[model samples]
Target: MSNFVEFTFRGQPGYSEPTAREVITSSIPVRTIAIYCFDPRAADAAQAVADYFGDEVYPGDLVLDEADRKIGSTATVFPLIVGGGRAADALRSITVSQHLFGIERVVVVHHSFCGATSFTAEGISAAWKHEHHTDISSLYDWDGISIADFEKSLNYDVSLIRNSPGTPKHIEIYGLFYDIGSGELTEVVRDVPAKVA
Candidate 1:
Protein backbone atom coordinates (compact mmCIF):
# COMPACT_ATOMS: atom_id res chain seq x y z
CA MET A 1 0.00 0.00 0.00
CA SER A 2 2.82 2.34 0.82
CA ASN A 3 4.38 1.91 -2.60
CA PHE A 4 1.08 1.96 -4.45
CA VAL A 5 -0.12 5.11 -2.71
CA GLU A 6 0.30 8.37 -4.68
CA PHE A 7 -0.24 12.01 -3.78
CA THR A 8 -3.23 13.76 -5.36
CA PHE A 9 -3.52 16.64 -2.97
CA ARG A 10 -2.72 17.80 0.59
CA GLY A 11 0.86 16.58 0.33
CA GLN A 12 1.43 17.70 -3.23
CA PRO A 13 3.46 20.72 -4.35
CA GLY A 14 0.56 22.53 -6.00
CA TYR A 15 -0.79 23.00 -2.50
CA SER A 16 1.88 25.64 -1.92
CA GLU A 17 0.26 28.41 -3.94
CA PRO A 18 -2.07 30.47 -1.78
CA THR A 19 -4.82 30.65 -4.41
CA ALA A 20 -4.30 27.12 -5.63
CA ARG A 21 -4.02 26.05 -2.02
CA GLU A 22 -7.24 27.83 -1.14
CA VAL A 23 -8.96 26.28 -4.14
CA ILE A 24 -7.87 22.82 -3.07
CA THR A 25 -8.54 23.35 0.62
CA SER A 26 -12.06 24.63 -0.10
CA SER A 27 -13.16 21.10 -0.96
CA ILE A 28 -13.98 21.40 -4.66
CA PRO A 29 -15.97 18.77 -6.50
CA VAL A 30 -14.42 16.75 -9.29
CA ARG A 31 -16.60 17.27 -12.39
CA THR A 32 -14.96 14.30 -14.01
CA ILE A 33 -17.79 11.92 -14.71
CA ALA A 34 -14.88 9.99 -16.16
CA ILE A 35 -11.78 11.34 -17.87
CA TYR A 36 -9.71 9.24 -20.28
CA CYS A 37 -6.56 11.34 -20.10
CA PHE A 38 -4.14 9.95 -22.74
CA ASP A 39 -0.58 10.94 -23.68
CA PRO A 40 2.82 9.63 -22.70
CA ARG A 41 2.73 12.64 -20.39
CA ALA A 42 -0.75 11.81 -19.14
CA ALA A 43 -0.37 13.58 -15.83
CA ASP A 44 0.32 17.02 -17.30
CA ALA A 45 -2.30 16.65 -20.01
CA ALA A 46 -4.84 15.50 -17.45
CA GLN A 47 -4.15 18.52 -15.31
CA ALA A 48 -4.67 20.79 -18.30
CA VAL A 49 -8.09 19.23 -18.87
CA ALA A 50 -8.88 19.47 -15.20
CA ASP A 51 -8.01 23.12 -15.28
CA TYR A 52 -10.18 23.57 -18.34
CA PHE A 53 -13.22 22.07 -16.67
CA GLY A 54 -12.33 23.43 -13.26
CA ASP A 55 -12.80 19.90 -11.97
CA GLU A 56 -10.67 17.68 -9.85
CA VAL A 57 -9.94 14.25 -11.32
CA TYR A 58 -8.45 11.22 -9.63
CA PRO A 59 -5.51 9.58 -11.31
CA GLY A 60 -6.72 6.16 -12.44
CA ASP A 61 -3.65 4.83 -14.13
CA LEU A 62 -0.18 5.97 -15.11
CA VAL A 63 0.01 5.98 -18.90
CA LEU A 64 -1.67 3.38 -21.12
CA ASP A 65 -4.76 2.86 -18.97
CA GLU A 66 -7.87 4.99 -18.96
CA ALA A 67 -9.29 6.85 -15.87
CA ASP A 68 -7.68 8.98 -13.18
CA ARG A 69 -7.30 8.87 -9.36
CA LYS A 70 -10.08 11.46 -8.57
CA ILE A 71 -9.49 14.61 -6.58
CA GLY A 72 -11.26 17.16 -4.27
CA SER A 73 -14.69 17.53 -2.73
CA THR A 74 -18.12 18.55 -4.10
CA ALA A 75 -16.78 21.50 -6.12
CA THR A 76 -13.12 20.66 -5.91
CA VAL A 77 -10.81 18.36 -7.86
CA PHE A 78 -10.63 14.64 -7.25
CA PRO A 79 -8.09 12.48 -9.07
CA LEU A 80 -8.21 8.69 -8.69
CA ILE A 81 -5.24 6.43 -9.09
CA VAL A 82 -5.26 2.97 -10.62
CA GLY A 83 -2.51 0.44 -10.35
CA GLY A 84 -0.34 0.03 -13.45
CA GLY A 85 -2.49 -0.72 -16.50
CA ARG A 86 -1.76 -0.87 -20.20
CA ALA A 87 -2.60 2.09 -22.48
CA ALA A 88 -4.18 -0.03 -25.20
CA ASP A 89 -6.18 -1.98 -22.63
CA ALA A 90 -8.05 1.09 -21.36
CA LEU A 91 -11.32 1.30 -23.34
CA ARG A 92 -11.70 -2.48 -23.21
CA SER A 93 -10.86 -2.47 -19.53
CA ILE A 94 -13.73 -0.08 -18.94
CA THR A 95 -15.99 -2.36 -21.00
CA VAL A 96 -15.52 -5.10 -18.47
CA SER A 97 -14.88 -4.43 -14.79
CA GLN A 98 -11.18 -4.29 -15.43
CA HIS A 99 -10.78 -0.51 -15.03
CA LEU A 100 -10.37 0.89 -11.55
CA PHE A 101 -12.79 3.71 -12.46
CA GLY A 102 -16.02 2.85 -14.22
CA ILE A 103 -16.55 4.03 -17.79
CA GLU A 104 -17.99 7.48 -18.44
CA ARG A 105 -17.58 10.25 -21.03
CA VAL A 106 -13.87 10.14 -21.77
CA VAL A 107 -11.57 13.02 -22.60
CA VAL A 108 -9.22 11.43 -25.15
CA VAL A 109 -6.36 13.94 -25.12
CA HIS A 110 -3.35 13.37 -27.34
CA HIS A 111 -0.68 16.04 -27.29
CA SER A 112 1.35 17.70 -30.06
CA PHE A 113 5.07 16.95 -30.22
CA CYS A 114 4.30 13.68 -28.49
CA GLY A 115 6.65 10.85 -29.17
CA ALA A 116 3.67 8.54 -29.41
CA THR A 117 2.54 10.23 -32.62
CA SER A 118 5.83 11.82 -33.62
CA PHE A 119 7.52 8.71 -34.93
CA THR A 120 6.21 6.43 -37.61
CA ALA A 121 4.18 3.52 -36.30
CA GLU A 122 7.07 1.18 -37.03
CA GLY A 123 9.55 3.59 -35.46
CA ILE A 124 7.64 3.70 -32.20
CA SER A 125 7.26 -0.06 -32.24
CA ALA A 126 11.02 -0.37 -32.30
CA ALA A 127 11.44 2.17 -29.51
CA TRP A 128 8.80 0.52 -27.38
CA LYS A 129 10.46 -2.86 -27.85
CA HIS A 130 13.85 -1.43 -26.94
CA GLU A 131 12.62 0.61 -23.99
CA HIS A 132 10.29 -1.98 -22.49
CA HIS A 133 12.38 -4.94 -23.66
CA THR A 134 9.62 -6.76 -25.47
CA ASP A 135 9.05 -7.83 -29.04
CA ILE A 136 6.60 -4.95 -29.42
CA SER A 137 3.92 -5.19 -32.02
CA SER A 138 2.13 -2.01 -33.10
CA LEU A 139 0.16 -0.71 -30.10
CA TYR A 140 -0.39 3.02 -30.63
CA ASP A 141 -3.60 4.36 -32.23
CA TRP A 142 -2.53 7.44 -34.15
CA ASP A 143 -4.86 10.40 -33.59
CA GLY A 144 -2.76 13.08 -35.29
CA ILE A 145 -5.10 13.86 -38.14
CA SER A 146 -8.59 15.41 -38.13
CA ILE A 147 -11.13 14.70 -35.42
CA ALA A 148 -12.65 11.95 -37.54
CA ASP A 149 -9.59 9.78 -37.11
CA PHE A 150 -9.56 10.63 -33.43
CA GLU A 151 -13.21 9.76 -33.05
CA LYS A 152 -12.66 6.62 -35.05
CA SER A 153 -10.31 5.44 -32.38
CA LEU A 154 -12.85 6.25 -29.70
CA ASN A 155 -15.64 4.60 -31.68
CA TYR A 156 -13.55 1.50 -32.07
CA ASP A 157 -12.93 1.57 -28.35
CA VAL A 158 -16.64 1.95 -27.63
CA SER A 159 -17.37 -0.96 -29.92
CA LEU A 160 -15.21 -3.14 -27.76
CA ILE A 161 -17.06 -1.85 -24.75
CA ARG A 162 -20.48 -2.46 -26.28
CA ASN A 163 -19.60 -6.06 -27.09
CA SER A 164 -19.11 -6.77 -23.42
CA PRO A 165 -22.11 -7.92 -21.40
CA GLY A 166 -22.15 -5.26 -18.67
CA THR A 167 -20.95 -2.08 -20.27
CA PRO A 168 -22.19 1.41 -19.44
CA LYS A 169 -25.28 2.37 -21.42
CA HIS A 170 -25.14 6.20 -21.38
CA ILE A 171 -21.51 7.04 -21.85
CA GLU A 172 -20.58 9.85 -24.28
CA ILE A 173 -17.10 9.83 -25.70
CA TYR A 174 -15.15 12.88 -26.94
CA GLY A 175 -11.79 13.38 -28.60
CA LEU A 176 -9.32 16.28 -28.68
CA PHE A 177 -5.85 17.07 -29.91
CA TYR A 178 -3.87 19.13 -27.40
CA ASP A 179 -1.04 21.42 -28.36
CA ILE A 180 1.74 20.80 -25.88
CA GLY A 181 3.74 23.93 -26.73
CA SER A 182 0.84 26.36 -26.55
CA GLY A 183 -0.94 24.51 -23.77
CA GLU A 184 -4.06 24.63 -25.88
CA LEU A 185 -6.71 21.93 -26.17
CA THR A 186 -8.64 21.73 -29.42
CA GLU A 187 -11.81 19.77 -29.84
CA VAL A 188 -11.29 17.07 -32.40
CA VAL A 189 -14.72 15.52 -31.96
CA ARG A 190 -17.80 16.73 -30.17
CA ASP A 191 -19.82 14.55 -27.83
CA VAL A 192 -21.08 11.35 -29.39
CA PRO A 193 -22.89 8.49 -27.72
CA ALA A 194 -20.45 5.73 -27.05
CA LYS A 195 -21.46 2.28 -28.30
CA VAL A 196 -21.93 1.06 -24.75
CA ALA A 197 -19.39 0.98 -22.03
Candidate 2:
Protein backbone atom coordinates (compact mmCIF):
# COMPACT_ATOMS: atom_id res chain seq x y z
CA MET A 1 0.00 0.00 0.00
CA SER A 2 1.23 3.47 -0.98
CA ASN A 3 0.60 6.71 0.94
CA PHE A 4 -0.70 9.85 -0.68
CA VAL A 5 1.53 12.93 -0.55
CA GLU A 6 -0.32 16.23 -0.42
CA PHE A 7 0.30 19.94 0.23
CA THR A 8 -1.33 22.21 2.79
CA PHE A 9 -1.32 25.89 3.77
CA ARG A 10 -1.51 27.14 7.36
CA GLY A 11 -2.95 30.61 7.27
CA GLN A 12 -6.15 32.59 7.71
CA PRO A 13 -8.40 33.14 4.70
CA GLY A 14 -7.25 36.09 2.53
CA TYR A 15 -4.39 36.77 4.95
CA SER A 16 -0.96 37.69 3.66
CA GLU A 17 0.72 35.82 6.49
CA PRO A 18 0.73 32.31 5.07
CA THR A 19 2.73 29.33 6.26
CA ALA A 20 3.36 26.26 4.18
CA ARG A 21 3.71 22.85 5.71
CA GLU A 22 5.97 20.13 4.41
CA VAL A 23 4.46 17.50 2.15
CA ILE A 24 2.37 15.17 4.26
CA THR A 25 1.43 11.62 3.42
CA SER A 26 -2.15 10.43 3.81
CA SER A 27 -4.33 7.50 2.78
CA ILE A 28 -5.50 7.36 -0.79
CA PRO A 29 -9.02 8.51 -1.47
CA VAL A 30 -11.71 5.88 -1.92
CA ARG A 31 -13.33 5.84 -5.37
CA THR A 32 -16.54 4.57 -6.85
CA ILE A 33 -17.05 2.07 -9.66
CA ALA A 34 -14.65 1.83 -12.58
CA ILE A 35 -14.86 1.03 -16.29
CA TYR A 36 -14.55 -2.65 -17.28
CA CYS A 37 -11.97 -3.07 -20.01
CA PHE A 38 -10.16 -6.03 -21.58
CA ASP A 39 -6.86 -6.45 -23.40
CA PRO A 40 -3.61 -8.35 -23.04
CA ARG A 41 -1.82 -5.04 -22.48
CA ALA A 42 -4.60 -3.84 -20.16
CA ALA A 43 -2.34 -3.30 -17.16
CA ASP A 44 -0.12 -0.80 -18.95
CA ALA A 45 -3.13 0.87 -20.52
CA ALA A 46 -4.93 1.02 -17.18
CA GLN A 47 -1.95 2.76 -15.59
CA ALA A 48 -1.90 5.26 -18.44
CA VAL A 49 -5.61 5.86 -18.07
CA ALA A 50 -5.23 6.37 -14.32
CA ASP A 51 -2.40 8.85 -14.87
CA TYR A 52 -4.40 10.64 -17.52
CA PHE A 53 -7.47 10.79 -15.29
CA GLY A 54 -5.42 11.91 -12.25
CA ASP A 55 -6.25 8.96 -10.03
CA GLU A 56 -4.37 6.31 -8.07
CA VAL A 57 -4.42 2.93 -9.85
CA TYR A 58 -4.43 -0.40 -8.02
CA PRO A 59 -4.15 -3.92 -9.42
CA GLY A 60 -6.78 -6.63 -9.75
CA ASP A 61 -7.44 -9.37 -12.28
CA LEU A 62 -10.84 -10.54 -13.48
CA VAL A 63 -9.41 -13.95 -14.30
CA LEU A 64 -6.75 -15.96 -12.50
CA ASP A 65 -5.00 -17.58 -15.44
CA GLU A 66 -1.62 -16.23 -14.44
CA ALA A 67 0.45 -15.99 -11.27
CA ASP A 68 -1.70 -13.61 -9.16
CA ARG A 69 -0.07 -10.66 -10.87
CA LYS A 70 -1.53 -7.20 -11.04
CA ILE A 71 -3.84 -7.10 -14.04
CA GLY A 72 -5.76 -3.87 -13.78
CA SER A 73 -7.18 -1.15 -11.51
CA THR A 74 -10.58 0.23 -10.48
CA ALA A 75 -9.42 3.79 -9.98
CA THR A 76 -10.79 5.23 -13.21
CA VAL A 77 -12.31 4.22 -16.54
CA PHE A 78 -9.58 1.74 -17.45
CA PRO A 79 -8.99 -1.82 -18.49
CA LEU A 80 -8.87 -4.85 -16.22
CA ILE A 81 -6.73 -7.86 -16.79
CA VAL A 82 -9.09 -10.09 -18.80
CA GLY A 83 -8.82 -12.75 -21.40
CA GLY A 84 -9.66 -11.80 -24.95
CA GLY A 85 -13.38 -11.87 -25.90
CA ARG A 86 -14.28 -12.73 -22.34
CA ALA A 87 -15.97 -9.53 -21.23
CA ALA A 88 -19.26 -11.34 -20.69
CA ASP A 89 -17.64 -13.27 -17.87
CA ALA A 90 -17.44 -10.01 -15.91
CA LEU A 91 -21.19 -9.43 -15.75
CA ARG A 92 -21.34 -10.85 -12.24
CA SER A 93 -18.70 -8.45 -11.02
CA ILE A 94 -20.53 -5.55 -12.58
CA THR A 95 -23.73 -6.52 -10.89
CA VAL A 96 -22.00 -6.99 -7.56
CA SER A 97 -20.24 -3.65 -7.82
CA GLN A 98 -23.47 -1.87 -8.58
CA HIS A 99 -25.23 -3.68 -5.78
CA LEU A 100 -22.55 -2.75 -3.29
CA PHE A 101 -21.80 0.83 -4.35
CA GLY A 102 -25.05 1.78 -6.08
CA ILE A 103 -23.19 2.42 -9.32
CA GLU A 104 -25.48 3.68 -12.07
CA ARG A 105 -22.86 4.03 -14.76
CA VAL A 106 -20.49 1.56 -16.37
CA VAL A 107 -18.07 2.08 -19.24
CA VAL A 108 -16.92 -0.81 -21.39
CA VAL A 109 -13.54 -0.04 -22.91
CA HIS A 110 -12.36 -2.28 -25.72
CA HIS A 111 -9.27 -1.64 -27.79
CA SER A 112 -8.22 -1.74 -31.43
CA PHE A 113 -5.83 -4.39 -32.72
CA CYS A 114 -6.79 -6.69 -29.90
CA GLY A 115 -5.31 -10.15 -29.79
CA ALA A 116 -8.78 -11.42 -29.01
CA THR A 117 -9.87 -10.76 -32.57
CA SER A 118 -6.81 -12.43 -34.00
CA PHE A 119 -8.14 -15.94 -34.36
CA THR A 120 -10.94 -17.67 -36.22
CA ALA A 121 -13.17 -20.27 -34.59
CA GLU A 122 -11.42 -23.08 -36.35
CA GLY A 123 -7.99 -21.80 -35.46
CA ILE A 124 -8.93 -21.22 -31.86
CA SER A 125 -10.48 -24.66 -31.58
CA ALA A 126 -7.47 -26.31 -33.10
CA ALA A 127 -5.09 -24.40 -30.85
CA TRP A 128 -7.10 -25.17 -27.71
CA LYS A 129 -7.51 -28.81 -28.64
CA HIS A 130 -3.79 -29.19 -29.29
CA GLU A 131 -2.73 -27.33 -26.17
CA HIS A 132 -5.09 -29.01 -23.71
CA HIS A 133 -5.66 -32.30 -25.53
CA THR A 134 -9.38 -31.66 -25.32
CA ASP A 135 -12.00 -30.65 -27.85
CA ILE A 136 -13.54 -27.34 -26.85
CA SER A 137 -14.83 -26.31 -30.28
CA SER A 138 -18.37 -27.47 -29.59
CA LEU A 139 -18.64 -25.48 -26.40
CA TYR A 140 -16.67 -22.32 -27.14
CA ASP A 141 -18.68 -19.49 -28.68
CA TRP A 142 -16.15 -16.89 -29.82
CA ASP A 143 -15.68 -17.89 -33.42
CA GLY A 144 -13.86 -14.98 -35.01
CA ILE A 145 -11.98 -12.13 -33.40
CA SER A 146 -11.75 -9.23 -35.83
CA ILE A 147 -12.04 -5.47 -35.94
CA ALA A 148 -15.66 -5.90 -36.94
CA ASP A 149 -16.24 -8.07 -33.91
CA PHE A 150 -14.93 -5.45 -31.51
CA GLU A 151 -17.98 -3.23 -31.31
CA LYS A 152 -20.33 -6.17 -31.71
CA SER A 153 -18.66 -7.98 -28.85
CA LEU A 154 -18.68 -4.86 -26.72
CA ASN A 155 -22.38 -4.36 -27.35
CA TYR A 156 -23.03 -7.99 -26.49
CA ASP A 157 -21.21 -7.54 -23.23
CA VAL A 158 -23.18 -4.39 -22.42
CA SER A 159 -26.40 -6.18 -23.13
CA LEU A 160 -25.40 -9.01 -20.86
CA ILE A 161 -25.20 -6.62 -17.89
CA ARG A 162 -27.98 -4.28 -18.91
CA ASN A 163 -30.45 -7.04 -19.65
CA SER A 164 -29.67 -9.18 -16.65
CA PRO A 165 -32.59 -9.49 -14.21
CA GLY A 166 -30.14 -9.17 -11.34
CA THR A 167 -28.92 -5.78 -12.63
CA PRO A 168 -30.97 -2.65 -12.22
CA LYS A 169 -32.62 -1.45 -15.41
CA HIS A 170 -31.73 2.21 -14.92
CA ILE A 171 -27.97 1.65 -15.07
CA GLU A 172 -26.38 3.58 -17.91
CA ILE A 173 -23.91 1.79 -20.14
CA TYR A 174 -21.23 3.39 -22.34
CA GLY A 175 -18.72 1.89 -24.75
CA LEU A 176 -15.28 3.19 -25.72
CA PHE A 177 -12.81 1.97 -28.30
CA TYR A 178 -9.22 2.62 -27.33
CA ASP A 179 -6.65 2.86 -30.07
CA ILE A 180 -3.48 1.17 -28.99
CA GLY A 181 -1.15 3.04 -31.34
CA SER A 182 -2.58 6.53 -30.84
CA GLY A 183 -3.78 6.28 -27.23
CA GLU A 184 -7.18 7.66 -28.11
CA LEU A 185 -10.54 6.72 -26.64
CA THR A 186 -13.40 6.98 -29.11
CA GLU A 187 -17.03 6.52 -28.20
CA VAL A 188 -19.05 3.78 -29.87
CA VAL A 189 -22.70 4.74 -30.06
CA ARG A 190 -25.39 2.32 -31.03
CA ASP A 191 -29.09 3.14 -31.08
CA VAL A 192 -30.16 4.33 -27.65
CA PRO A 193 -33.56 3.27 -26.41
CA ALA A 194 -36.16 6.02 -26.61
CA LYS A 195 -37.44 7.41 -23.34
CA VAL A 196 -40.97 6.46 -22.46
CA ALA A 197 -43.64 9.10 -22.74
Q: CA lDDT of each candidate?
A: 0.46, 0.52
User: How far in Å is the alpha carbon of 138 misplaced in model 1?
Assistant: 7.7
Task: Return the TM-score for candidate 2, rounded to 2 decimals.
Answer: 0.58
* TM-score (C-alpha, index-matched) for candidate 1: 0.46
* lDDT per residue as tens, model 2, 1-197: 22332221333344332111111111112232344335545545555444444544544334222687433333423234455534455567766555444544555667777776676777877988899998987774452233347667777766765777766666666566677787776667332445668
Kindly list the per-residue Cα lDDT of model 1 for residues 53-93, writing each as its tens digit.
55455443222213554443342223222211112445444
Question: Pick by TM-score: which candidate is best?
Answer: 2
Indicate the residue-level lDDT of 32 in model 2. 25
TM-score of each: 0.46, 0.58
Candidate 1: residue 63 lDDT (0-100): 28
